[model samples]
Target: MQVELNSVWQVNGVDGLEKALYRVLQLYMKQRVVILFPLSDSKALLRPVKIDFDNFSEAIKVGNARPSRYDLPYYQLQYDDEISREHLTKRDEKYTLIVDLVSNPDFLLSFVERPRSKLVSLHAKTHNTYVQNIYRALNLYWKYAQERNALLPGYKNSGGRGKARVAGEIKRGSPIQLSSSSIEAPKGVNTSESDKELFIKAMKKFGLRGEEVKFSRVYDKMLKEYYAEELISAEAESREAKVPNYRAFIYWVKKLIPTDTLIRKQTNQGDFDRNKRGLRGAATDHTEGPGSCFELDATVLDVHIVSDFQRNHVLGRPTVYCVVDKESRMIVGLHVSLEYASWRAGRQALINSFTSKKEYCAQFDIEIEESEWPCSHIPLRLLCDRGEFICKDAENLAVPLIGHLSIAPPYRAELKGIVEHRFNILNEKLVHELPGTTKGKQYDRSVKDPRLDATFTLREITKLLIDEVLEHNSSIFQDLAKQSILLIESGLSPTPLNYWNQHVKAQRHALSKADEVHVRSRLLPTTKVTMTGKGIRLNDQMYFESDHPDFDAWKIIARNNGSWSLDALVDHDNSSLLYVRLEEEGSFIKCYLKKESANFANRHQADILFFKDWVKLEKNKAKPSAKSIERHNRKKQVIESAIEDTKLEPKVGSKSKRTKGMKARRREAILAQRLEESGAKPDQEYSSVNSEQSSQRIDDDRKKVISILKRKKVTDNET
Candidate 1:
């Protein structure tokens, strides 16, 4: 910003105006006199003015304010305080500038014609020649101010008197934004200082939060903070640093460090994964029609409820399972249990979702119109998170039952927003509001023993959740209805069942009785068990063909496999039953327990821990004394006699050859009985087995005859 005047220089017209402004630049660039008084005009106009801004103790007011119309003289001299006093006084000085009157003569009358003392007037009667000169003069100084403001250093480009912008033409409303961090890297800098500052700011906004958040959330915070900085300065030179060009830099940094990866590195995989999925899921269109897609997820219900078996023992928090239709947002199926969010909890929830409304409502004894909970059809696609959904057990159950199954990447609940939102509703709107509710956290549980206050048992909690889900599905909300653009267009109200009823396509896939049996069997947890001559040994307990009709076929499968080790499916929820593939029948047969362990309470809600505790309990059981054994047999005999005395004829729903029971039948006679028996018996002796008639078989033939003669029979006449 220096001008070397070797010898003397003179300019004629517009060029002379630029020269005069450049002289002011050279003086200010080398001297810090801005904080001082205005340059004094006691020094001649032809003489250059200089003052040391750092050390000056003098004042000089330099301008020709009083002038006569008769002499050719300058009115206002050049003034550039744009970044001057701000650097000096440390006040709210903005990088703005102003232009003073130049010696140009055309504009001299323009200022005069404005009614101010400038040697002329712009009245209606003023001469045409003077009026024309006024406009020309106004144009000339505007150009001069533009030239002067462009040449100052550290003068940031901005807008208005408020934003301190450069002298220039303006377009419509400002589309370009400005921020300080968007300032260009000063020349000779090796790294992206802007990017570094942005990283620290973004991390401060998001990563500093104790809990792990999603990349989208962090990116959003960064974008918000980025806009708050000073992007473009008021100097014409800095105008080229507009933020429109570098808008992508902040976002690119966020993408470089994915939030999901951060969570995986620093926190629980499940916690991070669930949140990541939720964040990732926000960028989607979930307005699907009913039965097209459904989302399933599990969360620990916020309330503490007692066990159904022991009301005094409070279960910390019951895990809740929900299956929600993407389109209708209906809670189609729900399961609330003490079980953790494993395959079994998700299993029961899936079954409830697909089961008939009549039967499901009967369990809770809730009466409502079938239309109130109409979502019974299986969805074409089933969506779930990575936790249980990624397991083979979950996949096997969902794939065949649903045509398409989607397990979103871990920790991403956003991918399954419908069910997650429903879970939030249950926590905030239902569980947390109830008595005995822990309201989350162990410290929260200590204020009062939820156990002492706990009135809701496991069964009651399930009922409460069921009632809540039912109400939510059937409740009408105008705001919710408006969310579906299609529904709004169609003039439909938003209730879960209503959204489903009006928009669901006719191609809904429903499970038949056979399909339910197939899917239910697949959902069972698989384990390897030894098939011995006695029976299948599981948990050191035996299962015999006599226990259930299914065990008979299951035994045959074991025989076909050389009567050794085989894979069997177990219902952890119902330890009383087991299933094995019947290749000839093209289905699975249900096996009942021949002998149950002492802990096997049929109605007791069971989780994986039940077996773990059972194992531990059995290990420490004391052996019975001789007198206790004798008394046990006597009690068993008395119970048997009582059963025989009070037994009623077992009702016969269908006819089968096994009804004869013992009847003094030979082993061959009983062995020949096979309703679905196909193919020749296996030639290999290991694969073949013959059964003996039971000495104590229940006489179904006598029962069947008596049931037909004197019972509630559906005869044609009665029908």
Candidate 2:
């Protein structure tokens, strides 16, 4: 049985558990294995009977009184959580009580359930014996109650008088109701039946115990479906004209936009509307005047043709420059040429347009029925892009006869967008309809495309352009008659020739019949030099003297390939070698030197060295001294020793013998003989003469001593 005597964690108090201790005795003391609860009671165990209290009077009473369950020997298990003098003195005392109050569980019980009397007794032990007597009196009362069994309601005393209270009456506490039915209601509070019912329904719908359904997912799905429906309806509503579909818009953006910023939302509405709107209505009021604005451009043909005269038995194909009048949209000029878009080509086209006879012009002159003056009436402004031809001097495209020409700005394709768009339409509709266009279809399957040979020459590309232009003017008509106004006013014969003649005839300073080569004052300035037959003419002052020795027996071509100064080209009489001016400015300059001229020049000043000789003379000025040569040799030796590990063998095909035949064997034998002569033989051990001599003396001394001893022995024996 475990016994306990209660104490407290604090100084003075009557603990609730300690007040109920005697009642526990009434309930459980009858058992043979009695466990005195130190957690609830500070009862001292004496010799005869248990005091079950810490005070002296209670101990005396318990020692004398006879209780029913006093048969067993008792142990008092008191715990002192704090090391105090009162508790220490009590521990040191020699009472007939076995007190154990040291270990963890015992201390914990006393600490958790300390009684007020025990706390009082602890103070009394230090203060006065009177307080101790009071503690003892309370302890006696506790013992008396335990013997009579007359304690509180929750706990019974030793006698049966406390039994009725333990059964029904209150002891430790006053009469109180703990059951929910017996609880008193607070005043001035009321609840309706409807409110309660509503609260219950709300709890069932959104309570913590059940699964919660989120409406956001459903809302998102509904939004997506709604967006899809709205998009479909928007697309259906916008099906007007030749607008592109959504798929085409995607394709355009994919091809054009940068990958990182290629978001559909970032696309501009203006660009979208423009791309969706296809080509329409070529006519506009922006056309300048009759023959004032000309649209000139070249287009490449899809067809391929052979241009070599021997193979094809055909002249070169032609390039036609079709200049359309801005008002009529009619061809003011059309000419074919072997050159494609070159200055020569464009000049030829311009010349051919104006120079064509009235008879030939009349043949295709449907626009102007019958007029003698025909195209020779009006002044014209030739409009085209800033191509090489349109920007060249008189002999090229700016013939004195041709009118003022205008050039479009660089990369502003929209200025020439009229021609570009027209070309596209022709290719899609008319050009592709031709047999020439379909010729490339056969080479589509070849790994080495046959178009390599069949590709269109510049001539062929020209003819195709001409044919397309002529067909467009004759066959195609404007739906609105006003659209044809520009075409009619642009030319006489409704072609290139009509416009050129009109431009030429209206010229203020027309070309004289004699001057085929126009020498414009603007081209040849007064200060600039010129090339003539006389040679090196500066501002028309000739300087070349063919009779001079420098030019003897030589043909000199006096020409300047457009540099600041004249360049001399003197050819040898008997040889193909040409000598050019080497040092004209009293300074050395590189020139093509004929061997003969070079020899002559050197002979004039025999001792004077040329640049190459001077270079050699400077290099030979400083040579290495003997001491430096010796140091270099020593350094070279060191380098050779460092590199000796490299075993060099000649290549097999080289002049030296590579095979291990007679020559290799002979070389090996010679090397071995040299090694033997040097005393580098593998089996030879080299010892110095000094070490050999010292060892030789020791051996000789041993032989000499033995000889002496033998002689002495012989002598002794004889005696």
Candidate 3:
């Protein structure tokens, strides 16, 4: 090995490949790397090492082959120092020198001639003089080839090695002696121009990435066919018969095509685009404090949960929303719902996140101190997928939090590791243990119908989730972040709750009592309503009205004709009372149903539309238990009852005085219409006119009458 001549060079950034800005880094930094080490297909062992200044290798800086990234391969450079490992230079006795030849054009040209492989592969393949001469020529190519200016002026002396025709004496069928200065060229396979075209076309087709049969496989199949072999074999310019083969084709492909270009042809755009974008952000992105980054995500619960109001009403897979702190990886809040992943689901989760966990836990009979779940704070940023993250419900909640909301790329769940991992843990521990667990893709749990195995109601499972989350928050956690340059500054503790207790609680933004109440009231799922003199109507049948201070303010706004449209944030589980936003006072009014007295208190908890339909169906029944009604059967009964209620039984004999003479009037009108349609005008007809036109009109009217009577007679017969 030879080292480069000494030259003074100043160190600079790995050329502005900053990794901090893309991810949330309020408190910590982490980096992940994968490198294709030279001379090996395996990944390199990436680490910082002590190296002698004289032994340091100035890594080859090549122009980027990627069209999208015209800049240097900054990511690949992260592992450039791996080649400078001590063992790479040391042979036990002393350190060996590393060479740098990127600036030498002459060396690059010689390198292209495959000097290393030639030097390593020299062996006698055939007995004889010419073959031995070919070996000597290649041996000479391995050395003294880099001194191009002296030996290959005008690049002519390179011809001696290029054609291996030293002194132009080695020829076909010539029994030449093998000597140091006289050598023959290696045998070159010949192919017809037509076969060359066919080879190129096949290469183009095989270059594209896919799951289909590969180029080598196709070549093997083609070689087995007699007709294909005949088409490829042709007389070359040297009068030698030649054919296209897989090995020669592969060699050409590697010689002509760049690696990325070949990969791009084989795979789709998504593969390269993802690779170039880099899967995870640099560790610096999460250097901020705990409250700075909150990850929100929704996933279907593994276990089945039945409706709260109806025990046996299995709601299938309820969507579960989770909010977690990126810094601590602590689950801050969660919501389990009978609905799908909608804006409402996101709002429910946000409400839980901003509320006091002590009070929230008490609702489920779990005791916890405010200090235990002190994660309540407005995040500087909320990271989520496009699902509910971009919905209006999330937007409304974000307004108060004053945080930046980012949508993670669909494939990058690694960005939201905090919430995503929590969901994984929740399923592994809580949901999988339940009787009706789907247990993911294994199919064993779901094969027998998980719905049939469902034993927990929504309310019961909700309490279970509360208990699980509380346990998770209090449990000790371990930090498994990779060792990196970023980890040197701050030592992140393993326990999320302890870290929150020690530092994040003091630094996080806390919601005031008023702000908490406002957020709690605002984050409930909302439906549009109109503020009318009668009241606010929702779910088609329920009307909300009240004398609450908020309602009074709403009435004032409605009276002033302030646009007329209003929104009601209703509790999905309990539909009795609804909250209306009063922007006038920056407060909410709790409105009770106008017909609350007519329905059972339990009906208030049911979904308004479903409940109202049930109320009408069971209006006169002595027992109106929600559990007794199968959801489908209840819907069927409700629809049938509704139809019956809306049905009008026409009176027999003397319908109503209002409709008494309607039949006779209709009869007369029908007759006049028939006569007028037959070219008879009221203003000119119905008089005793003896004119010829009058007589023609009378005859036409008679014909129309006869036709209409015949049709009516047939209808009557059919009836």
- What is candidate 3's CA lDDT for residue 321? 87
**Model 3: per-residue Cα lDDT over 586-649, one tens digit each:** 5677777777433422232333444565568777676745665677688899999988876765
Q: After superposition, how far is residue 585 of candidate 1 from its true place, in Å?
A: 3.7
Q: Quick one: how many clashes does candidate 3 have?
A: 19
Per-residue C-alpha lDDT of model 1 across residues 599-706, encoded as one tens digit per residue? 452332453354457568877886798999999999999999999876765666656644565444654454455322544554332134322223223454455554
For model 1 the local lDDT of residue 555 reads: 65
**TM-score of model 1 (CA atoms):** 0.45
Which 10 residues in a row give candidate 2 its minimum summed lDDT?
570-579
Candidate 3 similarity to native, TM-score: 0.49
At residue 654, what lDDT does model 2 achieve? Answer: 44
Report the error of model 3 at residue 675, Å.
Answer: 77
What clash count goes with each model?
37, 29, 19
After TM-score superposition, the amount by which residue 470's alpha carbon in candidate 3 deviates from its true location, in angstroms, is 2.4
What is the model-wide C-alpha lDDT for candidate 2? 0.38
Q: Go through the candidates in order and give each one's C-alpha lDDT.
A: 0.55, 0.38, 0.55
